[model samples]
Target: MSLFKRAAVSEFASNASVVFSTLIIIWLSIVLVRLLGEAANGTIGADVVLGLTGLTTIAALPTVLAAAVFIGVLTTVSRSYRESEMVVWFTSGLSLLSWIRPALRIAVPAAIVVGLLTIFASPWSHRQIQEYRARFELRSAISQVTTGEFLELEHGARVILVEANENDPEKLGQVFVRIKDDPWHSVVVSDHAKTEVAPNGDRFLVLEEGMRYDLTPGGLVTRLWDFDEFAVRLDSKDAEQTLRQSREHALLNHKGRPTGLLLTDGKSHSDGQLMWRLAIPIATINLALLAIPMGAVNPRAGRSFDMLVAGLIALLYFNLINLSHSWINNQTLPFGVGVWLVHLVFLSLTVFLFWHRVRVRAPKNPSD
Candidate 1:
């Protein structure tokens, strides 16, 4: 309840909010522009681009919070040293290690938010993104009909392949199809094709100048027929929904799993991902504490060397965490030994630096 402690905590919280907000704005702008480009190229639907970008930003909050904590602590401490306030505190018995109390107050809440995002919100966001992509692919397959790709229709019972377009957008350059519905299997190849619509709103791909191969299920009979024209109707909306659900079910992976589920399952990749998620908040706290000792500065210097050093430490810390994830997933490192090693290493380093800062200070002359 000391004035110094209250003032320091408030200052750090304020600085972190300002810095975190600014970094979020910048990161979102860059991510949004890239995501919008994906939308334009048909990688994702235009309608969901902004929503996806928002989810993407939410998933990235840990990185932003970490950076904000680093800068907040560094800025707070370096400014103290530069203005000679640290000298006053050092003389009055406030050691450099004492900075941890206030720094932690900000770090704890930030860590909790990071954990929530990483554990729950992130998975939900990724799941939504995947569903949006699946829905777009389904709608685009029937509505837009891009060339040079195979479009699966009717729960894998029928497949339609389109080759590169030849000039007229309304006309398909070349079409190939294979259909297997219970007792019969057939192959159809066409010189060119185009889409036609009936009065009832049913859409069909009309093939021109084609050959058909028809076979019985028992291989007892086979026939080849030359046809001047043929028609394959696109699936109805209900059929499309079935296909979409099938695709969604197939794509359920670790990225879409909640943290609680991942914790219980403990598969190699899932465990690794969960550890990394937990590490973000832990890493933020570690880096903030580390920055206290790292951020001692000479005000006369042209640039803030302490700030740069803190940044380098953070960069190295994150890279090591990434490396540890790979090692754990590959079975080179034990799961129990993965992320904690990084934390312990940096924690020791922070403690050492803080101890050195305290020990290296000169004794105050009692006469003064």
Candidate 2:
């Protein structure tokens, strides 16, 4: 509420916004590059790529926000020292702890946003990603076959090539197929081939006037047969219709399941997921606290030192959280302990740093 506090908050917010935007753009750029490659390979569609990237960005927002807040506070405080702003404030009886009030003012709202993203938005995004992948995989088998190119299907069980026939997309004037099943290796070549859909909608590639050759994997003898009609299974409509279960059974659901459901779920994995969702928001707050002291830099030493330290601390904090999550899932660490211990450690560190900064003597003023 005071003029100094207002000015400090405004300064911190501005710096945080710039840092956050820069980091997000950089992160998104890397993700987009990878996603584009996958799309081109037919692993995913353009729409699905966009959806996945957008959701991943939402999932990553908390960490980005925490980093931004840390850098923002660090820049603001470090600059204050460099420009003698802190000297004026110190002369007026303000202490380092005075920074917390303004930092918290910015951080509290950020923490709320992180909570919503982790608990609500992230889960929904994950579900959408899973659904998109499921649909893509089911349709991928048939969509992969291209004219004038040899196609490997069913883990290389069959290889087929269609040559020529511009008038018909599903018809080929010349067709060759090799089916390798270890003991019995069969090769089929046909003068003409066409695709047909049964009433049940299953697809089959029908070959006309084709000759088949079969040879055992390690046999000197080979068998040959002449056939007028040969049918090869083209696509499994049934497989496409059967929905696969999603990999995302985490406590957070797109529809926003109550935290209690996650806590009480019988599955240990769910408990681990639940804890992760809850921990993200708490981590945001702790990171904010940690930032206050981590950002305290001596202007003479340069602005980069505090930023480097902040980056290291952030990296360590997130790594510890990941390790704790694994431990909880494995039952090596109790859910109660693993979930909160990492947070408590960082929180204690923050408190100690805050105390140290406040108690330490300010740099002695130079004789004017």
Candidate 3:
């Protein structure tokens, strides 16, 4: 390789590393904060925070890497222009188009990484996230109880307090529960408690050798009873509703499905997902090339305008990619067309910009 190409590739690599690190740090901070908030609210267990954070970061790598490569190419070229290095290269018979090779050297590899992530690793991470949530949801409210702390379930309609059994960490001892049933309030005190799943798939908290007291509001009536075993249904209406909302909130559907499955399905929704997965890697290459033209700026002029324009173009590129997904899924656009239309448009823009730059600002020939 020529010295110019070597220098360009080296600079691109360094800049991309800086950008990738910065973006990953920012992304991780945001994800960790959100996951910690969810953990605090009991939406997810605190123990799984790190696991989820890692998986979430894996799922986000493609977007972060794409931005890194794009910005790397843009900044590298723009700096060359600012430093008069481009003028030197142009005067030596190298055109603006010469940058494409070095830019692609950085871009093509990054695009492959993005492709692998989107097509395989990302979906696997999403699937693992869903599995984590599904397992958490399968646990009964009674099983969520932490000894020495009062636990509220079904929106505070039921409250439980239990002490740990020293001999068996999994067993609960000295269990007390208060249930508010509007017209009547019931309280139960039990020696020990365990969770049992009925044959019909309902969960119940089985209180052993317990005393039950039922009292009316304002002490209008009171009844007391003793029993060897008492069962309290854990699948309350409010709990079920909460579970449904949680499921819907985390539902990835096609996003979490394997690529092989997506290909075989051949449905519009699956096609839409396929479009998005394929678009990310394609955009990585297109945006890197597009930045070559965008990076051409006058040394005498302010950079704010150029930066703004470049940002808008990149934004529009991704937004249109997203829009194409919606259109394909809705059947408003055919899969074949929707997948290529946005990419072709940007590629055409890249080619036109290169041509204009070469024609309008072509270096003067020494013979002329």
How high is the CA lDDT of each candidate model? 0.81, 0.79, 0.88
| Candidate 2, residue 228: lDDT | 95
By summed lDDT, the worst window of 10 consecutive residues in model 2 runs over 247-256
Query: lDDT per residue, candidate 2, 1-368, as tens digits?
Result: 89899999999899999999999999999999999998877778767788889878887887788778777877888788888888899889888888888988888888888888877777666666667677676563445555677888787899898787677765677899999977899999998888777777677788999999999977898999999999888666565344434443322442334455666775666667777777777877787778777767776777776678788988898889888878877788888898899999998899899888888677887974
Clashing pairs in 1: none
Estimated TM-score for each candidate = 0.74, 0.82, 0.81
- Which regions of candidate 1 are displaced past 4 Å? 140-252, 361-368
Candidate 3 lDDT: 0.88
List pairs with backbone clashes in candidate 3: none
Worst 10 residues of 3 by lDDT: 236-245
| Model 1 per-residue lDDT tens digits across residues 178-274 | 9996578999999788887766556688889999999987778888989999989874445366566844663347777777777888678877888
> Candidate 1, which ten residues in sequence have the lowest lDDT sum?
137-146
Better candidate by lDDT, 2 or 3: 3
